[model samples]
Target: MGEFLMDKVDLDDVLDKFGVFDRYHAVSGIFLVLGMAWNAMWYFNFIFVTEKVEYRCADHLLPNNTSANASTTLWCANPAVCSEWVYDNPDSFVAEFQLACQEWKRTLIGGVQSFGLMLGSFIIGALSDRFGRKTLIVITGVTGAALGLAKSFSTSYWLYFALEFLEAGFGDVTSPLFTLAVEMVATKSRVTYATICNVGFSGGLLVVLIAWLVPYWRHFQRVLYAPGLLFIVYIHVIDESPRWLLSQGKKEEAVHIIRKAANQNKLNIEENLIDMISCEKDEGLSFFTVLGNTLKSKSLLKRFIVCSVCLIACTFASHGLIINSVSLSGNKYTNFALSFGLKLPSSILSGYIIAKFNRRSPLILFFMACAALCIGQPFIPKSKYLLWLLILTYMAGKLTASMCLNTALIYTFELFPTKTRSSMHALCLAISKIGSITATQTPLMMAYWSGLPTAMFGGVALVAGLATLLVPDTGNKNLPNTVCEAEALEYSDRIKK
Candidate 1:
């Protein structure tokens, strides 16, 4: 009986018996993806709303009698030509605020958002682990929606900037939502759910592309807010993660949810099946305890360092390439759309690669591919054909970076135990946000030399790719539910070696 109990006493077996990808799983997965799509709208909305449209100095600044040609010549002569501005698009923040020559301020808008994301990752990460995943989702979701609406009505750049920061803090819900999604599903289905969430995120980019038809930034911003309303419905339909429930000693609630899931899939679970629902009785394990344990474990610490480095490199290269692509010799809308569209296929491919191969190879391969492209981008000669070539190369680099990002999402989710999953996920994202903050400065780096930022992106990615070898591959393995289980897996591997 002890042997039989041991054979059937894991989360994976329980999930298998419960119907891993059943009707309930399908419904929950759909809602999770939609939630992800809503988060993505605000995350990428800045790209569209703050887009640099064509502008020139206001006519009054040119001179009273200035001909169009003389006005143009005089405008070129004035260093402070942005005293007043006429923009091709009357609604963009850049045009309204006369930010033509003040490119750094424009960059700040995105930079501040990234900063908020960084802050949110740490704050909300801890809060989610403490309060529960669903609670934080509702809190952050409502707050993010409110701020996004308020930001649309800002009367000044500073007001908009302040709101952007707050909205980002509230709006960066993807990491926690990701943790929730992974925990809700079966172990074998984690990658599929994560990739589906990514697909929804890419769908948010598509929503932005479609919203571009609205023709005014404020109107576009308002449209972005419309999706957040769906969160209200989410409050009614979504279930809290049962794994998280079990971990918190809410066994009754966990069993109820699992039975409901089984019923939704048309399976009648045995009444005594709850007896097999085994988990470590970690009633008071807090984030600090996990951190203390992690700090003491050489393997855990090494895994943290390697994973963090990989995340930083991927974030820097990906965001820098996408943000800098606006300066390339193509229509900004087309470039942005194409760049964002590439994520769809890359996300699908990432799911397949993770399912079929070890996690380390894909990260190493994609990061190195991106590095090669970034390093080669600056060497291409300036010509009409070559310009397109460079753009395609850059797009390929972005695609590879997307794959790295998708892999990292699953890799990190699987790397840690359930007790510390949310916090560790948040920490990884916070590190990536720092990399994003750095990527925001790519424009500043470009001023010194256009190739400099790409070179930096390449160098970091190369180091990250090589460093990936140090982290263990977690493909096709049961996820750890406690720190001891996580460490045991690592130690057992070492013992075999």
Candidate 2:
């Protein structure tokens, strides 16, 4: 009888493992597709759509003309140029365009809004932890898709501004989604799965490049909506995290989901495998209680602090570069396109480097090194070869950004307990948003005071370099599975027991 029971236990464990793997594969696949579709804007045309159209108009209108008749005359000369002229001077165009792309001092406001999204995601995170991951994923996905689609039709700047905020807020449901993916997957497979999913954000760059080849912003707007629409189809294939279900006291539901996962992975289960006893916490838990417990934990706190600052530094530097590129750099479109294209190689290289080195070390060294290069940028000779050199330096800054984003995501997930994962991740995002807010002005102010973009990038680089050194490493380990595990920890503590 004992031997027979042991055999059943082994079979159950095998089935359970297979189920987790199946779920990871499916969800990762779906998110990869969505990421490829959506994130390209950062690299592709998101930043330049306004600039491209505006420049086209500027080139045609001969600058400094104010009459509607004059604009109309120009428009008649070339219909495409005419359309660009109208968009160029709309009362709200400058503010709406800057805010939309998060450029200049407006980037500060935009960054704050990003924090607001984190706050929104925080609420979403709690509700997800309480209700079910499936519902929030579906709801947020729909909200984001609707907002993105509606944005294309917006007439006035305010209307577009409102939709832009909604689009940013709703699109970020992915923060919690990342936590959910990490929690639902087996301990060993997480890094690989998360990294692969993250590659989707890079894949988005490829799509954006295609959009850049097009001449019109309206068409680009149409292309931007495609990813959000594609995500709607995922509602059928994905479900709530079983870990969340267990935490919410839905043992039977968790079992059903797990069983389904096994079936999806094509694993065979013995009838007696279902008899194995599992630890399932079905008791309703308080959000305050969970939050307090998570914050007070030492190990989790260390991980959180390091992750937060690194993220902030990275965002400030990389996002600042992206936001200020068109205005600061000499050849706006070409520089922007080259910078965007570099993200692919940066992301690919970051993945490999993180897999090979200490996370914190790379972050610290790169920021400091990049800062020196940036400060010296203004001194570069204004020749073709010199311009290429400046571009290379700019690419270095972008590469650091990619490294920071990747490390923060992987490291934070690994450091926090499964129960508080969403909160921790949200907190990191919130801080990064703050960094972005500060960065919005870094270049503009530097230029105004010093009349040099290179000098500005260098100073920002110094700050980022210092911030990167302050954190510890949390890579290549199991995540904390519970709040208790996160709290009773040290620098080297693993979130998972």
Which candidate tops lDDT? Answer: 1
List model 1 lDDT by residue over 1-497, tens digit each.
Answer: 77576543555667766443568877877877888877877787787777766666664644543454346445656746435666767767788877766777888888999899988888888788887888888778878888898988999999999999999987677877888888887767778777877887777666546565775778887877866855766677888878888878787888888788877888876666665777555656566776777878887788888888888888888887777777777677778778877878999998888878868788899889988988888888878867878888888888988888889878877888888888888887887887888888787887688888888888888998998888777877788887777777676556757
List clashing residue pairs in candidate 1: none
lDDT for 281 in candidate 1 is: 51
Worst 10-residue lDDT window for candidate 1 reads 61-70
Candidate 2 C-alpha lDDT tens digits along 246-324: 5565657766876776676666665455445244563455566666766676655666676777667666666667666
- Cα distance off (Å), candidate 2, residue 161: 2.2
lDDT of 2 at 9: 34
- Candidate 2 CA-lDDT value: 0.58
Cα displacement (angstroms), candidate 1, residue 153, comes to 1.0
